[model samples]
Target: MKTLRFVASVSFGKDSLAMLHLLLEQRRSLDEVVFYDTGAEFDCIYRERDRILPLLEERHIKYTELHPAEPFFYQMFAHPVHSRKTGGVHKHGYGWCGGSCRWGTTYKNLAIAKHLRGYQEKVVQYVGIAADEKNRIGDKCYPLLDYNMTERECLAYCYEQGHEWLEDGVRLYDVLDRVSCWCCRNKNRKELKAIHDNLPRYWERLEALEAVLGNMKGKPLNEVVSCS
Candidate 1:
């Protein structure tokens, strides 16, 4: 019998890293590792990527970097829908994404999943949903093998693998969460505040997109957000 062909979606976060570590422990051979990048991601993300590159190099893991066909920021400005909210800040007018409304605009997340679907053989996608965040793990459209391990388990796996120095003396269990774009709607109150405080220009642009749309009360994104 042939071994299963699997692709591990690596986010360079604790959960995803843990999933990869678990696979390595099982002595499984991964066909590939996929990563999606939207141009608007944070500088810290790039630094993290730098750190991840050597780790992948050490492990000789094959990975692919997939970016959007169209530039996300360019599309944001070219369309009228995203144009109107150009400079406003604050969640009310600025189009910041949160729990109720995600701005319906996560290009990278879905794009990565879609790209994974095109592989030649049957693919088992491994997602980094934590045990504490069971709700984050959902019925994926394609074939998926999910493991909802806890944050503690994720860090412990890394520590067991001799990555204690990489933990940066930070409490791994508490700091094992993923980092994403500053203006992303999936963020919590603290994340939003951090964006509003640090990246005012980006925050303003998001607000402008929302102001242009005018319906913050759970309306369909198609009606409010138009690519044209």
Candidate 2:
């Protein structure tokens, strides 16, 4: 019989941070904490990871970081596309990922799955979904939901623990709902507008990508810049 290994998947977001804190507080048996880096996350997300590193070290919890085999830009701009009709290859990349075609999510999951395959033990992955997000609950173990913690409660708990996602005197939670990949095409207009207004460098990069890729979500990047 193989041993069971308990692992927590963290994104350094409010829910995940709260879940990790609760697991620690309750003295749960945690073998490791795994984080899948999308390579395009906001700076605050990385900073939050840095903030939590000491606690993981203090508790002697193994921390593993997994990254996609291909870079985000390469997947977006240079990936080869095979044409079924002509039996030829199109060098143009997959363009902007959105809806069900989110390649970033695919890459992240694949990387994590590949890493977990290395373990001979049975891996019980703990996700950080909140009670309010019951629709997102799957087969994974959700500690926050088990504790009846809502999304708002999770954020409150993280703030109470000094796990606020802050960058340049700006609180990220105040502007955006999720701190996922910065280049994600699924972001709403409000989130995109916030980035356009606050983060010029990132906005510029988005504009550059849009220039090369033509349009995203059937709209010009300038329209997002003028979002009210």
Candidate 3:
């Protein structure tokens, strides 16, 4: 029988990197390292992706960028209708999820799996979800979760191996926690403030979206900047 092709999900962040490190350390023969670029990714993520490419190159690992079609939550909102209270506005907020639109997790994740349907060999999909993020796990899964390593173990292993690069200086204090779309409802107000204070352009774009979609109601990032 032919050897299977293993896919390590890469997300320009510490946890994913650590997972890759662990896989390599085990001498596992992986065919590819894949990243699902959900266009809504943070602006800084592009640069991080480049830096990690060389590492993959040195290891002869094929790195692929996977882009999703319109985000999976396209059906969440109705067509924009001008409202007297909000004035002429676009319904941009329709896609924003609260606890109600839990679809955010399943939809995007399934989309990512759908995007990776090409490598048909027996496959092992390495997800970056850590043991600590219990809430982040879901019912829909890749079938290979049983053999996967958790984020906590990945980090400790990276540290023991002297990988300072994994120390991604982001506020989450994790090298492995590479989250996308700062405006995501899954993120706390502190993370949102960080985006506003550090990446002004992204913050402005999100604010303008709020104006059109009115999803945030009257609450603005400026109001909670200090707390974050």
Give the best candidate by lDDT. Answer: 2
The predicted structure with the larger TM-score, 1 or 2, is: 2
All candidates: CA RMSD (Å): 9.3, 1.7, 6.3
Q: Rate the local accuracy (lDDT) of all candidates.
A: 0.56, 0.86, 0.60
Give per-residue CA lDDT, model 2, range 6-52, as digits (tens).
99999999999999999999999898999988778888899889988
What stretches of model 1 exceed 4 Å from their correct place? 1-3, 80-106, 139-148, 152-178, 194-228
Report the alpha-carbon TM-score of model 3 versus the true structure: 0.67
Task: List ranges where model 3 is wrong by over 4 Å.
Answer: 1-3, 71-93, 102-107, 134-178, 224-228
User: For model 2, what is the alpha-carbon lDDT of residue 73?
Assistant: 81
Tens digits of per-residue lDDT, candidate 1, 52-111, equal 677667778777898866665554444234344575332332244446544324666778
Instruction: Quote the lDDT for 103 in model 1.
Output: 35
Higher-ranked by lDDT: 2 or 3: 2
Candidate 1 local distance difference test against the native: 0.56
Q: Which regions of candidate 2 are displaced past 4 Å?
A: 84-88, 225-227
Better of 1 and 3 by TM-score: 3
Q: Candidate 1: which pairs clash? A: 85-208, 85-209, 86-208, 94-207, 95-206, 95-207, 97-185, 131-149
Q: Pick the candidate with the highest TM-score.
A: 2
